[model samples]
Target: MSEVPSPRLRISDQDRESALTALGEHMSVGRIDIDEFGERSAQVTAAKTRGELSGIFADLPEPHPLLDAPKVAVSEPEKPAWADIPPMQRIMGALLPILFIASIALIITTGVTWWFILVPIGISAVGEGIWGKGWDNAHKKLGKQRRRELDG
Candidate 1:
């Protein structure tokens, strides 16, 4: 399209140069890799007419004015491990272990029936912890082990 209307018209040096620059622009943004660029550049250099030069961009996306506008980078979504946990579940996961351990210490110091109440609460806490975070944590542990093996 950079050339004159005649398909058989002999391409000038400036036309070949322009085509090569466009190829570089496409490659810079990962539209094509180094091997494809080399092959296209070779074709561009060997092209004798306007038609031959046009063939190189046939399959590539058309470089319209809209496409030439500034691009916005799309970032990956956040992946916080705790994002899916309910507030009460998260609180239970954090508090149950500490309170259970403290209750054990209290029971040791004084033989009291009040400490018995912690038994069901301790079980509930453990269950909530497993439900809320167990799968993600297990996957992360497995991934780490696999990576360590691979790296070794």
Candidate 2:
């Protein structure tokens, strides 16, 4: 008669605890979904020791197989220089010329060369536009950084 292969032993307590800790860290950092975290935690808790934990993991398919596999890093699509500018900034930029014209008309109506006022108002509008663009760029960068860190 042919001999049968022996079944693998279950994990031991120490290993199971270690695995649970690692799974907890992953879950805390939002790497794994709630369901996956619960399932893995249950598996680890069920294991009595290290060997049993190893056996349990060995039987399961690789988690994030894609992470283990080689992959090309995809570059983000090129954003237009103006794309980083916020809608409000873009709208303000569009209105700058009109504002400048209105300011000149006001200066003429007042019989004062309030052209000086135009300079400060134009500068302020430009500053706001620049500030808005910077804010948008920072937000985009932060979002990308978070996604990279989370492997999402």
Candidate 3:
């Protein structure tokens, strides 16, 4: 009632529907007759502005359109995919750059070219960190295949 900011504000289908529902409630309570309900319902349906709806409820009490506040749903904030990784895995993932740097330093100092071996290890560590236990299953499958090859 008093909440409507302006009389001239354009009404929506939802607003009209709310008014119609209120009118129906009024009719059911014997506040308004069927013919009067029909007439008021038509008026409500035809209402294009808040002003047009205001007069329809002028004679009625309590049950009015657009009086109750609409409800809003609140949701929890989403976490990033990396946030779900285990703490140990996250630590290993973080140390991957240091692994590469140390490998490169070893390669430069020793000139043995064995630093190439660290690349796969660093890649596997980071992959396990990001993909979690899924990487362990894949690693197991690879190991099984190698074992079958040796046994055969």
Candidate 4:
């Protein structure tokens, strides 16, 4: 079995700051995107604190390319609409149990059979799951449609 390399020494604050400064210089010279610079800077900073950043800097390219180019800003990725639905459905689905319990409490308070509440709750849960699944499938279909449109 091949032995894994032991972890390297933790990065110091000075090392992290220096790396960030270098990365900023790279970004300023258009060697790297703003998003890339920000991401790498954060990664280096976090890794320094957590002792994980050392391996990253070991194989350094001497005199990096960012020393000469003009700076450019990075464009953000567009957000998809379906990102909103899953969470909303999940929250509403979760609430179903609490609502069912409350309904049962109300029925008991009125001296009615608690069993009746089970039918509605069960039906609602099944319906919710089916609806959520259908919505997800629809989103997938839309994504496929968009991809086909783009490809064509």
Candidate 5:
């Protein structure tokens, strides 16, 4: 970015685009005024030679991208365990409420008391989910430990 490129050298599309991008960054950060940015941007787009492109940015400092990277991409972040809304929880959450309402209506109409069976089933389902999660965590930990043992 130090040496102004050869003035008379033919420019490539990439060179023009790079200059245009640099101009945009400079304008966005208030290094140059909007009018200057617009004028230079037009000149950059129409520039046919490396010198014409270089002249547009001759007075400006290097753009931000040239100074430092904006961001480094790491691996995609994982969703937390709690954020993983399981399908069974979703289905049963809705079904439980509906079942409770139906149980109330059925008891009021028939006094049969048989629809109450779903209450125990719902409680057991919750316990199963809690236990299942514990088992999964324990299983993963054991797997890691086993791998380490084998590697050692």
Candidate 6:
């Protein structure tokens, strides 16, 4: 069985500060007037034990610091799966569209099947990203540095 805590337990400065803050909240909400706040603030300042501080909030409702629940911590939202990939892959992916546009433009202007050349090059570049290793360790390190520079 757990032992019951003594009312005579010494209160720390932090405990006194919390009680004072609670009293300030009570005063701010007009629950306690300025005169009563002064009295309560004095009591909080002179408090030496847990029992002494407890009486300061006896007549008040919620917002009692000692009795209040701890605040919950908020976690960061999840990042997309593709956020971790190196820049080379994204660049290669982007290259395909540009190549396609250029091929179309060339075909329209000169009308000589420019796509035959650009299409294979674009496919090979993008295919290397999908199937072949995009970069070695050194290149990956450089990509990370570049990402940091851009972000920072």
Best by TM-score: 6
What lDDT is obtained when candidate 1 is compared to the true structure? 0.69
For residues 16-120, could you state the per-residue lDDT of candidate 6 as single tens digits? Answer: 778889889999999999999999899989988878888888899988756233545689975543466567665555565567677777778888765456674
Least lDDT summed over 10 consecutive residues: which range in candidate 5?
Answer: 64-73
User: How well does each candidate superpose onto the true structure, as a TM-score?
Assistant: 0.38, 0.27, 0.45, 0.31, 0.38, 0.46
The positional error of residue 111 in candidate 6, measured at the CA in angstroms, is 2.8
Candidate 3 global Cα RMSD: 15.2
Tens digit of per-residue lDDT, candidate 3, span 25-64? 9999999999999999999988888889998999999689
Please write out the lDDT profile of model 4 over residues 1-152, one tens digit for every residue.
Answer: 97643445454565566667777776777777888777776777677332355444444443322222334568886555445555655555556657778878878788777776886567575755767544424345446657976897
Q: Model 1 clash pairs?
A: none
| Error at 11, model 1, angstroms | 0.7
Candidate 6 accuracy as TM-score = 0.46
Ranking by TM-score: 6, 3, 1, 5, 4, 2
Question: Which regions of candidate 2 are displaced past 4 Å?
Answer: 1-7, 48-152
Candidate 1 C-alpha lDDT tens digits along 1-152: 47436867777776777788888889889999999999999998998977787788888875411212234568997555556656655565566656677777777778867757678476675765667535324335445566876797
Off by over 4 Å in 5: 1-5, 64-152
Better of 1 and 6 by lDDT: 6
Tens-place lDDT digits, model 5, residues 1-152: 57754668776666666677888888888999899988987887788876676667778888622322234467986544434545555444446546667777877888867757577466547746765543323334445566876797
Which scores better on TM-score, 1 or 6? 6
- Superposed on all Cα atoms, model 4 deviates from the true structure by an RMSD in Å of 17.7
Model 3 CA deviation exceeding 4 Å by range: 1-4, 71-152
Clashing residue pairs found in predicted model 5:
none
How many angstroms is residue 3 displaced in model 2 relative to the true structure, after the best TM-score fit?
A: 24
* Among all candidates shown, the one with the greatest lDDT: 3
Compose the digit string of candidate 2's lDDT tens values, residues 90-144: 5555555566787778787888775556674765557666674344234455456
